[model samples]
Target: MLYFCPASVRVRAASGAALKPIQSINAHPSNCICIKFDPTGKYFATGSADALVSLWDVEELVCVRCFSRLDWPVRTLSFSHDGKMLASASEDHFIDIAEVETGEKLWEVQCDSPTFTVAWHPKRPLLAYACDDKEGKYDNNREAGTVKLFGLPNDS
Candidate 1:
């Protein structure tokens, strides 16, 4: 398992009597806000306030790739169920989806407000995110919060 601290990512053995650190990586220059393991457990991704996302090899404990596109702090990250893509939500009102292997940006969309969270459907090509509407229109309505869903194009 992995633990994401302010500026580090620690790998721990989950089966041990006590979770002991196997390795630790100083992953980000600023606070690391989110970490997620891919579905296959072969790789993990970390998002930081320094406007960067890092992909790491689980066994090698080394960074395989770094994605630097966001101009604001990243708030959340989610990997597709197939583990081939990664999605990041940032405080700058944008969300980006990228190909995991090549760090190629698949697409990006701007939201009306800063996004707080993002998730990909476990069995489909649908992406969802929630935003914090500072305007208070959605919040005051007491309706469902500012949540949006997007359907991705077929890979073929």
Candidate 2:
């Protein structure tokens, strides 16, 4: 199964060689920029230019909750190894982490430039992130491009 989009997202069943579109959804007010599925595939998420991330239940095929901690267009999204924590990155100077089940923001990690990507360790709670300002697109891109690891625990 896949959830993808431009301004809207489509639910597709990717069981065979051909991609058969199952459904189309105007999932976001603005363009949907990125999407990610949790490790279990029971849940998936959509990040948008609206600066919001929408969580969807794979079974019910509906939005279960939303994360709106970012003020800039959401650039990336990733779920923790256990799929209990979700991290969102954007043009903002901070990357926001949210508790998947409760929709509560866990914390934010401050960075020197716009965050471009985030990946959770498959077996650990560590999160790896990258930042860049390619062509000086943002004013905070003083560090060039760097990737860093953060061992942020779910409890803290």
Candidate 3:
């Protein structure tokens, strides 16, 4: 399992009765806000307030790649069910999808409000995200509790 401590990430074994620390790495300069293990369990991703996303190899305990594109802090991350794609949401009004192996940006979508969370479908290339519209700019005078879904393109 993975532990998201402040400014670092720690890996531990869950086999024995007591958890044993395997390795720890400094993931981000600032606080790590979210973490997601890939569906294959061979890798994990960390999102930080420093506006970066890092992919780490589980066995080697080393960072494989780092993605830095957003100016705002990354609020959440989700791996596709097949572990081929990664989706990241930030405090800004956009969501970014990238190729896991090459760190190539696949696509990005702009929303009306700031997105705070993202989740990929378990079996399909569909993504769901929650937005914060506290100023009532998106909704019709109601509180800004909005969840939206989008289908990823096949060619990416």
Best by lDDT: 2
Question: Per-residue lDDT for 52-102 in model 1, tens only?
Answer: 989999888899999998988888999998999999988776788899999
TM-scores for all predictions: 0.86, 0.85, 0.87
- Taken over the whole model, the C-alpha lDDT of each candidate is 0.81, 0.84, 0.83
Cα deviation of 89, candidate 3, in Å = 1.0
Ten contiguous residues minimizing lDDT sum, candidate 1: 7-16
Q: Rank by TM-score, descending? A: 3, 1, 2
Q: Where's the lowest-lDDT run of ten residues in candidate 2?
A: 7-16
- Those runs of model 2 whose alpha carbons end farther than 4 Å from true positions after fitting are 7-16, 133-144, 152-156
lDDT-sorted candidate list, best first? 2, 3, 1
State candidate 2's TM-score.
0.85
Off by over 4 Å in 3: 7-15, 152-156
Model 3, poorest ten-residue lDDT window?
7-16
Model 3, 1-156: lDDT tens digits are: 656666244333343456555556777778888889999988899888889999999888788999998889888999999999999988777898999999999888787877888999999989999888756466567755887788856433
Clashing residue pairs in all predictions, respectively, total: 0, 0, 0
The better candidate by TM-score, 2 or 3, is 3
